[model samples]
Target chain A: MSISLPKAFNEFDEARQKGFIDVKELKEKGKNIVGTYCVFTPWEIILAADAIPISLCAMSDEPIPEAEKHLPRNLCPLIKSSYGFAITDTCPYFYFSDLIVGETTCDGKKKMYEYMNDIKPVHVMQLPQTTIGDDSYNLWRNEMVVLKERIEKEFNVEITDENLKQAIKARNEERRMLKKFYELGTLCPPPITGLEILKVLYGATFKTDKNEQNQTIDNMIKSVMEEYNNGVRKVSEDAPRILITGCPTGGATEKVIQIIEENGGAVVCFENCTGVKGNDTLVNEDIDPIDALTDKYLNVACSCISPNDNRIELLDRLVDEYKVDGVVDIVLQACHTYNVETYRIKKFLNENKNIPYMSIETDYSKSDIGQLQTRISAFIEML
Target chain B: MSISLPKAFNEFDEARQKGFIDVKELKEKGKNIVGTYCVFTPWEIILAADAIPISLCAMSDEPIPEAEKHLPRNLCPLIKSSYGFAITDTCPYFYFSDLIVGETTCDGKKKMYEYMNDIKPVHVMQLPQTTIGDDSYNLWRNEMVVLKERIEKEFNVEITDENLKQAIKARNEERRMLKKFYELGTLCPPPITGLEILKVLYGATFKTDKNEQNQTIDNMIKSVMEEYNNGVRKVSEDAPRILITGCPTGGATEKVIQIIEENGGAVVCFENCTGVKGNDTLVNEDIDPIDALTDKYLNVACSCISPNDNRIELLDRLVDEYKVDGVVDIVLQACHTYNVETYRIKKFLNENKNIPYMSIETDYSKSDIGQLQTRISAFIEML
Candidate 1:
C-alpha cells in the first residue's frame, strides 16, 4: 500500500526543489547560516548565537567528480561529495553559510576541512576521542568554550548561560519528539517506513527553526501513531526487522534503506553517527551548561573514539527496544574506524546477542546497488 | 672513509641471529615478556611489574601473505605483518611473549589485535586520542593502572610506587642516553649514519636489560662525540641534512632511511613515532608516577590524536636544534591517521617554517624501493 506523506513532509521536498528556500529565506532575513559536517558540531550554540545551523554532509554522486580534483579518489564518498558541493557551488546551504563548523571526528573529514577552509570560514572543533576521563571532559568543555567565543565574536551576540539553557530545552524537545517518532517503528509491521523516517530526520538537519521542526516531527509522529493504533501497517509483519548501523547515512545515501525495504526487510532503527543517535541524549541542565554539553557530546559513541564499547551498548539497547531480527552495518568506503569496528560489532551481534549481521562496504555510486540488494536479500532470508 | 662498527652494535645483531637472544634469555629466566606495538603502551608499567617490555610492531613484507588470510588485502602492512607473525608463528619475540599489549593508536592495528587475541593473550589498551583534556589524562592514567593491575595479576608481583619510581628512573636513563646519542647527529657531517641510529633505537625495543643498554649507548655516544670533536664527519657536510617523520619505522622498514642516506641526504634526526619522539620525554619523578607516565605518553604526539599541534612543536624544535634542511614524511599504506595529517604537515612546513617537505606513501614491499629512491634523490636535490 502506498502511504501519503504529511503536508509538512511535502513542504521539505518543495523547499529542496526551490534550492532550500527556508535557508535562503533565513539568510535573506539577516540570519547567519552555519554549515556543519557532523552532529557533534554544537547546533544549540549556533542557535544561541542567533545563527542557523545546517548539516552539510553531502550524499550525492554528482559532486564526486569535482571533489576528486582536490582529494584522493579513495576517500569516503560522503567527504568527496561534501567537498564537491562546496567546490562546485552546487549546495546553496554551503554557498549561503556565513561560517562552517568542522569536527575531528575522522581523519578524512578533518583534512577535508582544511580544503573547505580555502572556500569558506571553517571553525574546527577539536573533539577528544575518549569519554571516561576528567581531562577529556575539561578539554571538550574548553573546546566548546572556544567554539562559543568564536561564534559570539563572529556573530556579535552574547550566548549567555540563560541562552544556552533555552537552546538546550528547545533541542531536548526536538529530540523527544524524534524519539517518539522512532518508537512507531517498533510496532509489528512498522507504521512508518524507514525511508519515511530518514526523510524527516534528514530534513531536520537543514531546518533552522527548531519549533517548526518539532511541530513537523509531532505531526509525523501523530500520523504514524494513528496508523499503528488503527492497525494499518506499512510493511508485512513477517518482514525482517533490521537495525541499520555504522557510518552516517544522510539523505543522499539512503540507498541501503531503499534496498532493505525493497528486498523484504524493514529498518527499525538507525544506530549511526547521524539520525537518532546524534540527538538521542539531552544536555543535563542542572550542572554548568558547557559541562553538560561536553558530557553529552563526548559520550556520543562515534567509532572514532577508542574503546567504543558504548556504541555496542547503545546498539544492544536499540536491538532489544526495536525488536531487531538482524543488523545491516554499512561502512562508507575509506571509513576506517567504522570498517574496523565491524569485526567487534559482528562478533557481538552474532555470537553474543544471537542476532544475524551483515556488513556492507560501498560508496555513493549506483554500481553496487544490485550486489547490495542480493546480499541484503540473503540477509533477510536468514532472518 | 668507512666507519668501524662498535662491539656493542654487534651484540644486537648477534641477539637477532640467535632469534632475539635477549628476549629468549629473559623468558628462560622466568621473567614475563610483554610484547607491545605502540609507544603509548607504558613500558614503565610493564617494567615496574617485573616484566620485560618489547615492541612487536612488524615491518616485514614476508608475512603479509599470511596475514591476508585473516585480514583484508588493503590493511597497513605493519599491522598485517605483525598479525602475520602472530598467526604464522614466525617471530620468536611474539612466540615468547606472555602477554601482548596492543593500543588503539590506529584502527588497523586495533582490529588486528582482536585476531591476535585468538593466537595469544592480548591486553588491549584504550589509548586516548587527544592530549589537551583532563579527561584524557585521567582516562589514560586509569588505563595505565589497569595495565599495571593486569601485569601484576599475571606475574603475581605487586608494582609498588617505589617499583614504579625505579622503573621510571631506569627508563629515563635510557631516554637520556638515547637523547645524547641523537644529539651527535646535529653536528655537521654528523658523527653517525641514520641507519646506525635506527639500529640502536630498534634494538632498545626488545632489550630488557636497561643497564647494559645504557652502557652500550654510553660507549656509542663517547665514540660519536670523539668523532665530532675530531672533526671527522660520517657524511659530507654538503649532504642534505634531512629529518624523517610520520609513522614508526621499525628495523624491518628502514628502506626510507637507506634510500635517503644512499642518495645525497643524511638524516640528522627522526621525528617519527619509533625514534626519539616516542621516548624523548622523561616521566616527571616529582609527581605521582602514574600521572607523570600519563602526561609523558599522552604527549607522544601520534597522528592518531586530534589537534596534534604537539607534533608540530616537536618538529620545530628538532629542525632548529638539528639544523635540518628538509623533511621526508613516510606514511605506511592504509595508515589513515598519519596519511591524512601529511596535508597539514606539508602546509605547516611550507608556510610556517619554509622547509622543503616530501611525503612518501608505501608498504613493506620491494616494489616501491626504486620509486622511493627516486623521490628521496629528488628531495635531496631540491635541498
Candidate 2:
C-alpha cells in the first residue's frame, strides 16, 4: 500500500516542522500555549481560555537517553521521552508552553509529571480510576472546574459561557471531521496505506491552527474517497485488516505497524490514544459545557481506568466496523495498565469477536526491529 | 543474628503450614473467608460481617509460570503469583477463600483481579490516585460503604455500628502490637535478624485468629526486648543501619535483605507494604467507622499516589527514627510506580536526608541471587 499522497496529506505531514515556526511566531505574538500528553486533557477549557494546546512531543525515541538520566530505564518510553525533552529543552513545543496540563493517566506518566513540574509549571488533573459511581463523576467534573480556574488564573482570561459554547462547537466539529476521515478504513480496500493514514493522524497533534488542521483532514478524506470511488485500491482486499490498540504509537513503536503492513496486514483502525480513542467521542452541545467535557473526556477508555469495560466495548465495535481479521496491540514497554489488561483484551477478542489477537511490547529503542519483524510477519502469515 | 526464639516466635513460624490446616477446618466449619492483597483493604467491614480475612499468598515465584500463560511476562511478579495461585488452586489460602477483595492500588494487580474474578467472586474497590481532594475522601469513604454493603449482601449479614466498633478495636490492637514488634528494628545493634523480623511480619498474615496474631506479636516483642535489654548483642553495633522501602519483599525479593545483612548491614526498618506501610497508622476510633477506615488506609504510603509525598515523609521520619545510615528500596520487576519513584526517593534522600539510597529490582526468580549479592554487597560497603 504505497502511493504519493495528495497535497492535503503532504500539508498534514509537513505540519510538524511547520508547527515549530508557527508556535514560535504565536509566542512572539503573545499567545498562550499549554502542553499536554494525554487525550483525557479537556482541550475545550484551554480553548475557551484563549490558549493553544500542544501535545508535547512524547512519542519519539530521540530524547529518551536524557530522560533515563532522571527516570528509570524500565519506565514507559513516552514518559521518559517527554520528560527528557522538557529537561533538555529539546522539544520546541515544550519550550513554547506557558503552562503544562497533565492528567493522572498512568503511574509512570503521573509521577514523571511531578518531576516535570520543576522544569515547567504543571497543573495535574486527578482522574478517576473508573467511570462508575457518583464519586467518579463528581471528582472528574470538579477537576474540569479546577483546570478551568487554573487556566483563568494563569492566563488572566475569563472563560465565559459564550466562550465555552464556541470552544465546544469548534472542537466537536474537528472531532466529527477526524472521525469521518478515519472511518475510511471501513472501505473493503482502504484507499491509503496504513502508514500514510498514521502520518496524517499523528501529525494532527502539532498543527497549532485548529481551523487549518481540520480543513487539511477534511481535504485528505475527500481526496482519499475520490481515489477509492474511482476504483483505486491502495490496499488489497486479500490483505488482513489489522486493528491496532494499546499504548500510543508513532515514532519508535511505529515499527510494529510497518512490520504488520509489510508482512501482509493492513492496519485498518487504531483503538489506542492516538486514533479513535482521542477523536471518537464528541461532547454534547446541549448540556453544561463542563459536564459535557467531563463525560466526553472520561469516555476515551484509557486502560488506566479499572474495569475499563469501555476499552473492551470500543474494541468490539471497532473489529466489527473495520471488518478486522486480526488485532495487533502496540504496547509500549513497562506500560503496566495496558500490559496487564492485555490478558482480558485477548480473551474478549478471542471468545467474543472471534478474531486472532496478538500484542507487541517494545520501548522507544529501535533495537528490537528484527524481532518485531519476525513475530509480526508470522502473525500476519497466520492471518 | 540467629537465636532460637521462645515459644511465641516459634508459634508465628508454624502458622503458615498450620494456617493451611486451620483455614481448611474453618472452611469445613462453614466460616466465611475473604482474601485480600493490600493494607488498604478495610478488614473491619469483613470482620463485622463475621468473615475471616487472609492475605492471599502472592509473594512467591512458584505459581508464576501458570500465570504467565494468561498474563504478560513483564508484569509485577506479585500480581502474576497471586493470579496463578487462584487459577491453579496451588495456594490453600486462595482455595479456602469464599470471596476475594481487591483494591485498585496498582494497575497490574487491579487488572489481574478482573481475571481472578472469573475463578472466584472478587470485589474491587476503586482507589484514588491522590489523597488531597474531597473526591479522594468522599470517594474512598463511599467505597467503604459499598464494600460494607457487598459484604453484608454476600454473607447475608448486617454490619452494625457496634460490630464495626468491636472490629476496629481488635484490629487496632493488632496493629499497635505489630507496630511495637517492628519498632524493635530501631534499637541500635538490633536483637533479631532482618530475616527473622520479616518471617514474623509475613507469617502474621496467615494466622486466621486475630487474637492469637496480636498475642504472638506481643510475646515476640517482649522476648526480643528482654534479650536486647540484657545486653545480648547479636547484631554488630558498627554495621550500617539500613531502611527497606518500595514494593512488598518477603519471598524471592527478600534476597535483598539477605545480601545486605550478609554483608555488614543491619536493616533497621521496612517502609514497604509488608512492614510499616501496613501498620503505621491506626484507624481513628472516635470518628465514623467508614471515615476512620478511609483515612487510615489512605494514609498508607503506597507509590500509587500521584504526589507520593507521604512515602517521602514517612521515609524521612523512618531514617531519623530508625537512626538509619543508608536506604535500600526493594523494587519488584515491572512495578512501574516504585521503579519510576526510585528517582524521586533517591533525589530526596540525597538532598534532604544526607544518605546513600539505592534500589534493587528483582522478581521471584533465584537467578538474581548472585547479582543481588554482588550489588548489595557493594552498597553495604559504600555505607
Candidate 3:
C-alpha cells in the first residue's frame, strides 16, 4: 500500500522558514540563542540560563563546497556542511546564535572547533574518549559545570538549582513526547509515514515553546492513532521493516529513507543521532542536574566512544521493538567511528538478533542516489 | 660536496633484522614483551616491570590489503598497516608481544584497537582530547597510573617508585643523547644524512638496554662531530633546508625523504612523532614517576590535541634552530587530526615565520610516489 503523508503536518515543510522568523523575533526581544552541533551539548543548562538552544548541525550539500575550500573533501559531509554554513553565513541558527557550544567528540570536530573559534565564541567541552572510568564521569561533570558557568557569565544571569530542575523537567517531558511520537512505528501497519516522522521530529527542534510543542506532539499522536483506528492502513503490513542506524540523517541522507520506502520497506525506527540516539534517555530529575546531565549525555552511544557498548544495547532494543526484518546502517563518508564500527554492529545483529543487516556509506551529495536506489532495492528484495 | 654514510654507521641499516633476532632471543629467555602503537604509551612502566616495550606501529604497505579486508580503505594507512601486521602475524614485533598497549588518540586507531583486542591482549589507554583542562590532566594522570598497574599485573612484578625512578632516569638519559644526536642538523651543512638519522632513531627503539642504545647514539653523535670538524659536508650549503612535520614517518614514507634528497632539498629536521615530537620532552626527575610520565606524554604536541599550541611553539623553535627555508608536512591518508591541522600550521608558518610550507597526504601505497615527487620537486624548486 502506498501511504501519503497527512496534510495537516505538512506545516513541517515551513518549519525552517518559520523558525528563522522566530529566532529573529527572539533576537529582537533580547533573547540569547545558543547553537549546538552535537547531541553531547546539554541544552538544559542553556535553557535554565534563559537562552534558546537550537541545533546548528547542517544536513545538506549546498554549503559543502565552501567548507572544502578550507577542509579536506574526504571529511564527513555533515561536518563540512555545518562548517560551510557557518563560514558562508547561510545557516540562520548559526547566525542568530549568541554562543556556540562544542564538544571534543571526534578528531575532526575537535580540531575544527579551533578554526570555528575565529568566527564566533566557541566553548569546547573536553570529552573523554571512553565512558568507562570514574575520571571520565568526574571530568565530564566538571565540564558540564564549566559550560553552565560559561552560559551564566555570557547571559549575565544565574542558573539556580531550581531553574535547572525546572529546565530538566521540561526537557524530560519533551523527550517522552518525542519518544512516544516515534514509537508509533511499533504499530504493525505503522500509522505514519517515515517521512512524516522525520519532518515532525526535525521541526520540533526549531520550536521555542516547549509546552506548546508538547501539545502539538500530543495532538499528532492522537490523530495518528485515530486514523489507524478508523481503518487508515497507510503502510502495508508486509513491507520489510528497517531500523536505520549510524550517523545523523535528515536533510540529504533522507534519500536513504526515501529509497527504503520506495523499494518496499518501512523505516520503522531511526537509531541514530537524529532519532533515538538523541531521544532514548532522559535526565535524572532527582539527582543534581550537572551530574544528571553528565550521566545522561555520556550515555549516548556515539561511535566516538571506544568500546561503544551502549550503541549495541540500543540497537538490540530497537530491532525487536520495531519488528525489524533488516537493519540498514547509514554512515557518512569519512566518518571513521561509524565506518569502523559497522563490523561489530553487523556481527551483533546477525549473531544475537538473527536479522539481516546492510550498511551504506554516503555523503550529502545526490550523485549516489541511483546507486543507492539499486543497492537498497536489492536489500529490500532479500527481506 | 657529495658525502656517503660512514661504514660503521651503515650498521644502523641492519638494525631491523638484528632487532628481530634480539626480540626472539629475549622471548626465548621467557621475558615479557609489551607492544605499543603510539608515542603516548608510557614505556618506562614496561621497562620497570622487567619487560620490553617496542613500537609495533607499521610504516609499510605490505599488510594493508589484508587489513582492508576487515577495516575501512579510507583510513590512516599507518592504522591499516598496523592492523594488517597484527591480523596476518607478519610483524615480528607484534608476534613477540605478550601484551599490547594502545591509546585513544585518534578515531581510526581507537576503533581499530577493538578489533586488535580480539586477536591479542590489548589494553587501551584513554587519552584526553585536549591539554588545557585540569580534568584532562587529572584523567591522564589516572590513566598513566592505571597503565602502570596493568603492566605490573601482566608481568607479575612490582613496579615500585624506586624501579620507576630508575627506569625514568635511564630513559631520560637516552632521550638527552638522542636529542643531542639529532641536534647535529643545526649545522649549516649537516654532517649526517636524513636517512641515517631516521635509521638510527627507528633502530634504537628496538634496543633492550637503554645504556647500550645511548652509547650507540653517543658514538654516532661523536662520529658526526668528528667528520664535521674534518670538513665533511654531506649536504650542499645552499640546498633548501626543509623541516619534516605531521604524522609519524619511516619505512614506507622513507620515499618522502628519498624524494626530498633527490630533489634540491635536504631535510634538516623532523618535527613529527618519528623525530622531535617523540624525542622532544624529558620527564621531570623531580616529580613522581607516574605524574612525570603523564606530564611529559601529554606535552607531545600531537595534532590529536585541540588547540595544539605546543606544536606551534615547537615549530617556531625548530624553524629558527634548524634554519629551515620550508616545511614539508607529511600526512598519511585519512589521518584527520594531522590533515585538518594543516591549515593552522600553514597559516602560522606563513604569517609568523615567513616560511614556505607544503603538505602531502599519501597512503602506504607506492602508487603516489611519482605524484609526491612532482609536488615536492616543485615545492623545493620554489624554496
The superposed Cα distance between candidate 2 and the true structure at residue A13, in angstroms, equals 1.7
Candidate number with greatest TM-score: 3
**Number of the candidate with higher TM-score, 2 or 3:** 3
The candidate scoring highest on lDDT is 3
Candidate 3 CA-lDDT value: 0.88
Best by DockQ: 3
Q: Which ten residues in a row have the lowest lDDT in candidate 3 chain A?
A: A1-10
Q: B1-383, model 1: which lDDT tens digit per residue?
A: 22245666666545444447767777888988888888788889988888888878887889889877667676688888888888989899899999998887776776677668878999887776667656667767878888889999988999999999999998898888888877777888788888877777776665667797787778777766776777876788899898999988865568889989999789888888767777678899999999889888888888877667889899888888888899999888867778767878888889988999998888888888878877789888888
DockQ, each predicted model: 0.26, 0.74, 0.86
**Ten-residue region with minimum lDDT total, candidate 1 chain A:** A10-19
Model 2 lDDT, residue A139, Cα: 91
**Can you write out model 2's per-residue Cα lDDT over B1-383, one digit (the tens) per residue?**
32347556667766778999999999999999999999889889999888998888487898899999988898889999999988999889998888999988888887888789889999999888898877788888889999999999999999999899889999989989888888889888888878788878888888888887776577667767778888888899999999999998786776788889899999889898889997888888998888788888877798888788899889889999999999998888988889888989998999999999998889999998888888888988988
- For model 2, residues A199-311, the per-residue Cα lDDT tens digits are 77888888878787787677667767777888988889999999999998876777888888888889889888778998888889999888899899878788888779899
Docking class for model 3 is high
Candidates in descending lDDT order:
3, 2, 1
Q: Judging by DockQ, tell me the better candidate of 1 and 2.
A: 2
Tell me each candidate's RMSD, in Å, in order. 4.6, 2.4, 2.3
